[model samples]
Target chain A: MYVDMQTGTVETIMSNSDLPVVLIVEDEPDVAETYKLWLQEEYEVRMAQNGDEGLDLLDEAVDVVLLDRMMPGLSGDEVLERIRERDLGCRVAMVTAVEPDFDILEMGFDAYLSKPIRSEQLHETVDNLLDRSEYDSLLQEYYALVEKQATLEATKSSAELAESDQYDELTERVAEMRDQLSDTLGGIEDDSDFIATLRGLSEDDNN
Target chain B: MYDLTSVLEFDALSQIRPGSSILISGPAMSGKQRLAYDILADGIDGGDGAVVVTTGDGAGDVVEEFRSLVPDMNDAQLGVIDCRGDGGDQAVGNAHVHHVSSPGDLTGIGIGITKALEGLHNAGNERGRLALISLSTMLTYTDKKTVFKFCHVLSSRLDSAGYIGVFTIDSGAHDDQTLQVIKQAFDGMIDVRDAEGGGREARVLGLAGEPTDWQRI
Candidate 1:
């Protein structure tokens, strides 16, 4: 809605500096606009026509990127690789028409959305990405623990798992991680001491 | 939260709690997918997201078939793990559709389902249903042991994540061992087939307090 006709400058209607920025990197103009309309109210929404344009608009201020995988130039895959190489730290959701394959396991994106996304789907993806960005490090550890536990369970019988020392250790670590994650998630709503608490958690993770 | 009372739509299954898995086995083309889709539609109707892992049909076609039963369903309430590959890019308007390399690639399927589950969870849908359509196709591509291991991992994960799971298989295809391996992994089984008097019926097995008698469809 904040499009400057002459300069081709598109911005969210209400430019609230406090709101998180969401960049929509889609090749289809109509799709990009639809996403913009859906997200502009909650985020500082911006649109780029293709991969190159999307990269040009990328910055530290952008908290999330809804990238289309198969764009004309410098495809969304390339854009994602560049973003990771630059260590942008922004959460990238591959919003594309391509059906994901085993190649997706190697992709560096946070989330993937097939094309023709609905309004609520767009909103949910953005919100989820932002929530993840807030607790990035902690979530990684939590997920790792969960995966480890799953791996252990799948490889061992119930009697074997119950008697295994690795399972016991994993269970204890998982319990600790859950408690810490729950406490951290509770503090996310109140940003008063959020950064400080997050920093402390990250430091604890380092140790 | 992922209870079968909403998904199964049967008063008898109201006691089936969250985090339980059900196996729906029948002969080929006996409406196994239809039953699974009905379960999925029930979940969506109850405001829970639905994830469909299809080895048989394309993601779009699966969603289309689902719409035949639930006309007003939206893309926001659905996610698909499409295992069929025609070397063409397939994408639907609003649903989260992840594709695996091939039917034999259980790793690809696992990762795709995990991502879809996370997306639904992040969308604030703590309760959801995940349906793996037609284990027969999976068996065709991979060995029985591989399929069993993959199902074991997936079922265990779904159980712990508190999501209802509906898996379909062709009863006439697999041997007893194959069927038993999968049956041991699930909480219950529903065998669907032709009835004595020109109709289809489902008989629940292994679940407590349910009539062993076949119920008319």
Candidate 2:
């Protein structure tokens, strides 16, 4: 995903394949390290002690964030707001020790867990958030491919209607575009099914 | 007057009262979820309808955890809201399971709880129902003002419906200003922590028409 430096809208581009990354923002060293230990096996984990650091880490390839609610500078909530404002694609889950007040729930976090975090809850939240993010990314790629295919089809139909030498050249270009679109669409479908299978397996394992 | 000690000692958090909001505050890894599960399980075992809304964890994991503890909880009268998916609520056999994608989408949570309670009320059941979970995840994703508003709406709805509401919070997450705003909204507050030994301890910080005590759970 690429962020427009000025508008801050996320522009996602299709890639070959990449490992999901998790950004851990916590001032407490012990806590951050603990999350790293738990998540590193499945994800490429990155650490930041405060929100400012987390923002810097955001320049990297982060798919999800395990943000500590409290920190010395730029608290977790502040960082999250900035991320939303930038339209970052990264999912965030608040890891804190605050009571579950209704006010907190309305703030729009993906998930919340009180601190002294459980290994199970931590892993579950990260896995679910990452899976959701990946699914969303795949869906976007699928739509883009569909749009490209439709555009190519429209160009080809118009070229046929004209039946001129110039139109024939346009038809050749459209065919190439259609092949490319078909390849992209097929790849996305395969990825989507893989993600669905992963989700089903995880659910069954939990059960 | 109504044998307060027995109710406090034997009954789970949800059985304390109808339309009461109970705040279960504690540090992380303090077994808050376990306590919440136990309370819901107790209610289910007693044939009182219950709902568990999980923002961070999957409903299946929670169900599995409960099974690990009680073994017979699969047959219990409990409903779960997964709140992690976009479409359609699924019912596990007779129990209903709802999915929510974000913490901001708590309308689903409120609706699920309301439906459960209405069913119980229609059945002429006055034993009370429970909504157990946390809002910490929601608060972290949004701003303080939005969270405060969400809480106000939820508290008022639960209050009017007379359903038993218990939620956990992490004290270290909020500032004094934000904490005060939340404290004003709750009807009852139980401060839970690890005692000197291995067992848990709880102190009632505030309650409606009841004396406060800094005692153990």
Candidate 3:
């Protein structure tokens, strides 16, 4: 999928690359590097010390974000707010030492992982966020396919009604269009479910 | 059944009803969550089952609040699904309160709600007897479209299944457009504003087909 960073519009694109990208936005060099080391095997990892640098890396195909709550410049909350303002397509998990209070959770971090992070917690949070991102993308594709299918069904019904009206030549033309639309819609829907199931399986594997 | 008439200010909740989708809009310091707990507490005291899907708060916190509200209320009747821990099926006995890791997982939220409702129903509870308390933490991290769709699906399912769905919204955090969309989606809405003197006040906006027997807390 191709996401227009400026306009938050997502478009489907065929590309050879298949790895999901993860962006780590932590001010602490050691923490960011540790995350990179942990996640590099499964994802294309990128690191940014602050919110500004993280925003600069927004152009990359980032699927998940590991954000630190407290930073020297541009705190994690500020960075998250900016990311939302930009409508970036990445799931964020707030990694912090602060206790997971109601106020912190209410701030809208997808998942909250406290500092002194265990390898299991880090892996699970990243894996779940990626799974959700993929599922959301698949849902969008499914909705688009369903919309196309509904349009084709309507067109096909109209053509059948036209046939009853003795418009033989127009009926043939409409019938061809209907067939093409049905085939496209059916193929897209089938492919969408396949991809969605694949993503679900990958998520289960991580679990 | 307890006489709800004298227990609460009937005029305040005149717009609320059974099986209604209500948005308890308030500020962070305000008693939006407390009010939701009271509503569920009232249900449990009245022999109805309730399910709370916690997005921002922990199940223990919710249980503690309920305990404060109704100290003698049986914990068995109240189920809380905490989506704040690692994704696993951790139930607290018959209550069926499970822990979920992320708000981004709409599927998990949906599944948790389904399981909670089923548990309530299996315990001999009738339709219109279960209440859904979904704390609005997902609104901040997720996009408007995802939140809107999530609310849509949740409201639709609850309405069809005859469950009273009560959710919270932070008026200070969201824009006018998003707030308006959410208002249109719910069957009932309570605008909890700080009163001039002190405390808070709730204004009920009743949808066309909602019941007229909702009382104020």
Candidate 4:
């Protein structure tokens, strides 16, 4: 809605606080526009025709990124790689025509929606991603790791998983994440402070 | 002012109470989801707090359909812990909806349920219903014993909070031992199957004064 036709500029839309930002990274103009149209009413929709443009538009403030696979020039996967490298902390979903295989587990995307996705389905995916934003950063990473384990576990046998170094690394990574959570939350650094935190949340459900 | 189970239209379901967890068992496409949703629908319409842990379906669409069932939706309390492993941001239009990446993330799902329950209680709705859309999806990712233990813990959580729990399963999807193991978490079961001639019929199992007749659904 804030699109400037000539300069391709996005003006401040209602001060940006009223709406969560959604960036659509698709090479196809029509597809990009359609997604934008679907989202613009509720979100401050930003569109990128290619991966580089998508990255240029991305910022921590942006809540979700819908990246198109097989985009010419620095593909979606490569863009995803760069995004992870940057540590922007936004949820990325691959909206791709490519068939999802075990290779997808290697890519660091929050969700996968194969093309020919319905309007409502796209809306649902976006909404769910935002809900994910409420979780602490560690949990976000933890669940992504879990998703990969399940994805690979489904397509491969136990012997195959035992043999694959990638699977081993994934398992190690998941274990490390769990250790981090326990390390951060497990022990009482100060008993009084821990008790105070618990008191804030305590409800006597004994009834 | 209604008792937890008295809101349900079905007489057998109406006999259920607070702190009860019941499983709906049937083959694939046998209308088990409908029966469970109906029970939940009635509970929400009667002003109960509701939570749904979904694996395959999007929480937004599920909430959308659920709100439709309750004419007083604006006043209803609902929360969704979506475990379909997909993520993004849209205001599921209403209610507290949290996401976990996959069924494999049981810890995340557990935390989500706790947060949702807090939200509901904060909103002042006391009695409630919690539904796990299907356990079969979780069964695919975890072992039978793990799922059983998770159900046991979840049922106890609901009991402590004074909420009814309705869960579904594809009876044919898992082995008999697995089915028996998971069923132990619940006080009763709604066994759905094909009627003698046509349509679906269900009977309450494991409850005192059990409904022996297959009530046509």
Better of 2 and 4 by lDDT: 4
Local distance difference test, each candidate: 0.72, 0.59, 0.62, 0.71
lDDT of 2 at A159: 52
Candidate 3 — which residues are off by over 4 angstroms?
A: A1-207, B1-17, B86-93, B127-136, B208-217
Determine the TM-score of chain B of model 2.
0.78
Give the higher-DockQ candidate: 1 or 4.
1
Ranking by DockQ: 1, 3, 4, 2
- Scored against the true structure, residue A187 in model 3 reaches a CA lDDT of 19
| Candidate 4: docking tier | incorrect
TM-score of each: 0.51, 0.45, 0.48, 0.50
Q: Model 1 over residues A75-129: C-alpha lDDT tens digits?
A: 8888988876666677788876766763454455666778678888888778766
Candidate 2, A1-207: lDDT as tens digits: 888899998776532236678889999898889989988777777899989989988853777888889889898889988976665656778888865653443454666778778899898777766655554444334333333434444456655646656545654654454344324433212222222222222222233
Q: Model 3: per-residue lDDT, tens digit, B93-141?
A: 3455766667666555655666666666777665433333444577655
C-alpha root-mean-square deviation, candidate 2: 23.7
Regions more than 4 Å wrong, model 2: A1-207, B1-15, B67-76, B86-91, B118-126, B208-213
Error of 4 at B91 (Å): 2.6
Model 1: residues with Cα > 4 Å off, grouped in runs: A1-207, B1-12
Ranking by TM-score: 1, 4, 3, 2
Please write out the lDDT profile of model 4 over residues B68-119, one tens digit for every residue: 8886775338888999877846568658888887886665676677778878
Writing each residue's lDDT as its tens digit, candidate 2 over B1-217 gives 0112332452233235555666777887777776666666666555555667777677776666555655555433555677656544333454456566666554445545545555555555455445456667767755544444344445545545555667777766765455544554456677778888677777665554454544566
* Backbone collision tally, model 2: 23
DockQ of each: 0.02, 0.01, 0.02, 0.02
